[model samples]
Target: MEPRQLRAIMLYEHNLGTSARQTAEKINTAFGQCTIAHSTVSYWFKSFDKGDTSCEDKPRSGRPVVFDEDLLRSHLERHPDATTRDLEKELGYDHSTIIRHLHAMGYHKIMSRWTPHALTDSERAARVTICESLLLQPHRQDFLRSIVTVDESWVHYNNKTRQAYWVLRGERAPTEPKGYWELLDEKQTINATICGEQLEKLAPEIATKRPKRLSVSLLQDNARPHTAKSVRHILEKLNWTVVPHPPYSPDIAPSDYLQIIRTHLGKELVIYDDHTYYCNVTSANGWKKYWRCTRGGGTRCCAARLHLSPDYKVMKIINEHRHPPPRFIVRNGVYTKIG
Candidate 1:
């Protein structure tokens, strides 16, 4: 039997007013190989006599105790970004003890929210004005259904960050220096033309999947290519309503806030019909494969590349193209870009 079980039996004997020696004799008679020392029973009997009912051993004097909430709160106020490990070092407590106390105190670590750019007072006012105008539109739900948001981002040729790993003593941990310029993959900037035209082209198919009364309202940042005359002309011809947005407010933009493109790319294998894709040798690492466009004589195609995981899930589609997909392919009653 375990020490706890033996202690429980001792407590029961004490409740009956049995002496410590009598309890020890009864324990030896009931459980073989559990011959507890007589002195141990005497110690427990003393505790039970004093109204201690717990069967578990008492905490040792040297064992770590729960952290002070006031002290922890003050420390966090000074170092809001300090990690749990950092707190352990500073407060001289185990990681688990700190975590338990934090839970009891209702403290939780939260990541800082990311914003595309810090908004000035003027920008904030503009955002509010645009939002108020949008809300004032007669057909608000219809407008929302018609809104097609778009944004552009650079896709790095190589992973910008490296992961840490365990290593044996005397063996150095692997290191990939950020300053190794050659190790960095080429960066590509995509334009908004492709996104606008593709949405226009896909309108009929997208409509078939939804209610027929919906119209598309294009939402895009004020990037150069997005505001270009040619892009606006195409949007007008397609009859897409353009939604006004403030500069550098990606946090409010549906495309950035909802992460539509990122989620779409991460879930499926996507191919563009108009753009020819070639395997990029520079990014054929085990975790990801990169494919670049072959348009524009290798210089001018939408600077985007498709990143795929080993299992063929599209991790990301980097950059934007200045042109639309050359053609749409209809297969099995579904219109899809070429894969």
Candidate 2:
């Protein structure tokens, strides 16, 4: 396994109350003798004790392994739950190679929120009882035969439309439903007005789903539409409490806050030609820095990058992006981070 990946395992073992010596012995036995020294395992455990569980190399690195980033992405598309070690079976890569490329491609093991809503205690108990009953039943084969399993996937396609409608098309296909443009307009641009409306729409569903609860806690990102005056007013009128969010948080998952990895310059920004670039690679040489589009890792995966000299002057531009700029919301007038 790569040093970082192995350190991750050591952290995991520490969480499970395993001794450093035991973890070292286990890993060495599985991989080979002297694969990982007991001293190295203990050092990592000490680092974990200090609550520094970062797996990235501290700068200088090594190795000449071929860990296909595309194949790993494809594997993840098919098996989102696959662990780092699990990639070895299909990718034909060693632990170090896989870990190196995964980190290089900005991949990290994250907990997947599988269900839209969580099951209640009673619902969980009922499911447990149902599973127990099925296991105890003698006609287990019959039970299996009666159930159907399927997977959900997204399919996209495009078809050309005629420049103009023909006479053969009767009534112009009912004009494609009334207020179609209005519906599209409402969703096309989600500003303060639309965001407020969406919250109002969600109010009823929350009330219906969690009727017994006296209050609701709504957590949202620091997006402008989400925190605008109209949206805040709507939330206040609905009596929903809004959870405070960090100004520059890239993700708003509740679990993410549990392990805060504060960056040296939290999402450093660069403004050029009315366009924004985020600090993708930190400049340690005191001469040049690398910046990337705000939406580089999202569905758009914008490839745009900006190179800057030590004086913060633009050195070069790479590619183009077609996504909205990131929203920066500081609590006070202070610029905690900027270009």
Candidate 3:
């Protein structure tokens, strides 16, 4: 029997003028177990005598209140990125105390670094309108399968910058010359026509890799070259459908690689080259897998590990390689330093 039931029995026996020892003995005989001690019975009898009938534990004392909720909330509203130690110093409270109150107030630190360009009211409305229209389409999945999202970046040569490093006590710090610029002739910007031609060649390769049929949906931002009449004509003649994208909305475009990884959730199949890596049963319950670069250890092995979901979607990557791959040597046919 529970302690509360025993207490109830003790109260009843006490009302009948039975002593604490007799009540305890009667409880033990009735239950066929010596659950309640004479001391426990006497304690409950005294509580009942004093008009206290509740069986639950009383409220504990010395509950911590290190920081004011209103003050912390107001301060965080102004500076949301403040650290726990920073808050501790500002509020003149212990670090643990500050942390406790922060958790109590339902505040957590997250990486909220902004990546998208600032959008105006009209731009935001345009994105919503375009999204709604796309959702209403009958063949959304087919459209997505055909998308060949393209973006360009300028590759620089010999652009190493100096960084701080640990040095010996007597040694002088190494230096690199700053403010050097690459010549215009050294840089080449790709236009939409060149991108379209590349897509036409790549479509067959993509089809062989992907399970679905290849339909070219060329997705690009509102760059002058991308929206050019000549580029449009070339793509249309090649049977590629150009998806309409709102200006200043890189987050909505598949070309924004970071945005896609951050927003994607649930089951997704990711293929690397011709290999399809399913989730190994050795993985934990969570949706994360750590696959090594090479199956077996070797001298020229890559330390790089791919982080993916259970269904094989690439999430994050740890590319801190200790040694170059054997293929890298074969490509150059010579050993070279990689930056």
Candidate 4:
């Protein structure tokens, strides 16, 4: 008999002190060792009396497990960030049911969200080749003059977007709906390119003098609109250089440069669904007032200057700081920092 079967038989005889028929049932329930049938188990004892030891128990049967511990562990190790929902969908199982099973099996998702991006070895190699093919152009004056910084900003109305709650003692706070954006009139602005044309319209004097005209490289995100055929053709015709900012790098943007400016300007200029002033608040017409200016087509002059002390020289420090602290020491604390 195999060692495992022999052990099973010996355990049954020693522990239960019962016959093989009841022993097999106890083994199946206690150890999930369901290979031996009642008849086979009985025969084993009878044959043992005759000194004919043998291996006869067949393996268990089922629908066939698709994922064993090794396979599941491999998947989980490769996708550490995968959520229960993600694992359930990918492995073809009911989420709650899987969750219950995983709980019983002592497994848990490491993260709340996980969306795997599948790319083959060849595909990754091809991507590397394509990325390398993006040849860097030589530095030129024209490129510098053409550069424009494109970015996005959100505007909220009613009240500034903040999280807070009104609650009674021992009572849960009122919760806000996720579809608040649809309830209110919010605008998403995609500010593209602060170019010569834009600057000219923005500040006539600066445009007239050309401000030491040299080619400026345009700064933009990886949005398709930035590299659209029409946009590219326009930039090409103007001989403007286009350069993309690193993806998700806020340090390169003016917003980060003027972080205080944004904080100070907060709800005074911007609005959102979280605005307390707008909570369950609607315009008199029950709709947001739309203006052509809000559409972001024409140029508008905003003569806001960087908040610096009068004695502070703009050019004295080539790169004063990536981010300047709020003008705490300036204006004798009487005047706030400029936007």
lDDT of 4 at 44: 67
Q: What TM-score does structure 2 among the candidates reach?
A: 0.24
- lDDT: worst 10-residue window of model 4: 270-279
lDDT (10s digit) by residue, model 3, range 1-339: 776677778878888989999998898898876677899888888888898877765666543454477887777766665676777777666778777777676654422222235567998899999889888877877776677777653112354322332222233333223221222233554566765676667666776876465467778888787787877777777677778888866656654432111102332222232112223334556754765544245665444456766665567654333221212110111222124
Worst lDDT run of 10 residues, candidate 1, spans 176-185
Question: Which candidate, 2 or 3, has the higher TM-score?
Answer: 3
lDDT of each: 0.61, 0.55, 0.57, 0.41
The better-scoring model by TM-score among 3 and 4 is 3
What is the C-alpha lDDT profile of model 4 across 111-159, one tens digit per residue? 1111112446775575456335433445445554445565433222232
lDDT score for candidate 2 against the true structure: 0.55
Q: Write the per-residue lDDT of candidate 2 for residues 50-92, one digit (tens) a residue.
A: 9888877665345335556778788876765566677777677
Report backbone clashes per prediction.
4, 1, 2, 19
lDDT of 1: 0.61
TM-score of each: 0.43, 0.24, 0.46, 0.30
Task: Arrange candidates, best lDDT first.
Answer: 1, 3, 2, 4
Clash total of candidate 2:
1
The sequence of per-residue lDDT tens digits that candidate 1 reaches over residues 232-302 is: 88878877788998877664665543221222223222343223355554443554477765555655545
- The deviation in Å at residue 118 for candidate 4 is 9.9
